[model samples]
Target: MLVSRQTTVHPVAAPPLQVELADAPPPGVWMNSPQGSAGTIGGVGLRLLQALSAAASIAVMASTGVFPSFSAFSYLIAAASLQCLWSLAPAFVYIYALLVKRSLLNLRAMFIFSVGDWITGTLTLSAACASAGVTIVIDNDRKICAGNLCARFMTAIGMAFISWFALAPSFLFNFVLVVTTFASLLAP
Candidate 1:
């Protein structure tokens, strides 16, 4: 008897599975920060005030021919000149940030600003105080106001004080920005 053997076949196994994932979120802009827009605008305003006051001080001091005789007055002019330059850059930066509605108060920028503010503020205050002291001596103790020189000197000192006042606030504001930047970096 011839018996036909039954044919057995097994089906092929399925292919291995694969899973697809979504892309990650995009990174934020470098200028963007947690600091508000008002802070930037205020900073610009403060810097502008600083520049203007320092310029005024320089103008008033330089206008008088006798100012060259006094080293303190000359120091005031030099300090105010340097201060104008230092404050102008930050003013422009702040204006740009305000126009873009972003914050430029990053760690590096703020640190630079803080150091600049400290240096300029100290110089400005010292120059103003020295000039004021000299003016007081000439006006009160020495009684050397033959003409209107004393008046002009007093005006210059006043302007220097105003510039210093404006710069002090800007310096404080920079520190606040630094703190904010530090906090942001430490955040999860």
Candidate 2:
């Protein structure tokens, strides 16, 4: 009688930091990949936000439920939902990105961000729609947009106002500083 033998397996070794660096072309920067771009919202915070937004969207969308007869408003709701989702993605990305890095936050900037969120809430959604599932609101009719209902144009304006007056100055100042610093690095 003969018995079969199994070969042993070994774990692969991590690339040496020096070897990894040597493969770079110019501007020898370590960790240049966007792998670290992930926002560090702890599990609890992430879950809470997801639950809250989900509940709010469902309540609002269903409250304005569309039948074949209520087609206009149905399309409107669909458009608004889409836009809100679009805006939230990048807005949340940058916001949490900064927070995770322990970046300094100004009150004015935060206020602007909130306003921007409101404004974007009106956009990134049903710019216009004829179908029930569509929610982007792009209609110019005053009757439809009464008091920022269903993604008003004023919502976009409010976002701009909040961003410029509230958050722009801080972000601009930081951007300029970074540009100047980088320029100095390349100086001959």
Candidate 3:
């Protein structure tokens, strides 16, 4: 009689859980909805508006050699320049998403957009208000307002305000997206 050896086999366990980093909200969430598409479209449009307004403000402000005389105008030009660049980044991203992804679901990107929008919004608003105040003061002086330069200042301020207005919705949308995405990430 021959002795037989016993054999044992162990089944493989499931792989370790992994987390995926998204640049936007969860796919099944709002980012894929009709409302989400509309929001994305609106955001893209706003970015374009922001860029144009900022560029216009810069051009008008720089057109006058006296722009450097007013600190507020300088700040306005700087802020508008920054806003132009900031808006361009998101604008390109949104355009890419529209063409390829059909939706913007990047949580990280939206968060960034929110922060940038707020920053640019605040800067643009303050710059506009400050420049408007200075322009008003200049207008009151009569002598300072002798030239049409004050008109350019008013135009620049108006454009800055428009840029700020456009930034509002974009910021709001991204803020909601970031909050919801974070909440979703925390869910069990």
Regions of candidate 2 where Cα sits further than 4 Å from its true position:
1-58, 100-188
Q: Would you list the C-alpha lDDT of every candidate in the order shown? A: 0.83, 0.39, 0.81
Candidate 2 RMSD computed on C-alpha atoms after optimal superposition onto the true structure: 16.1
- Candidate 2 has its poorest 10 consecutive residues by lDDT at 30-39
How many backbone overlaps does candidate 1 show?
Answer: 0
* Cα RMSDs, all models: 9.1, 16.1, 7.5
Task: Order candidates by lDDT, high to low.
Answer: 1, 3, 2
TM-score computed on alpha carbons, candidate 1: 0.76
Q: In terms of TM-score, how similar is model 2 to the real structure?
A: 0.27
Best by TM-score: 3
- CA error at residue 181 for candidate 2, angstroms: 16
Q: Which candidate, 1 or 2, would have the higher TM-score against the true structure?
A: 1
| Top-lDDT structure, candidate number | 1
Question: Against the hidden reference, what TM-scores do the models get?
Answer: 0.76, 0.27, 0.78
Residue 131 in candidate 3 has what lDDT?
92
- Write the residue-wise lDDT of candidate 3 on 120-143 in tens digits: 889988999999999998887645
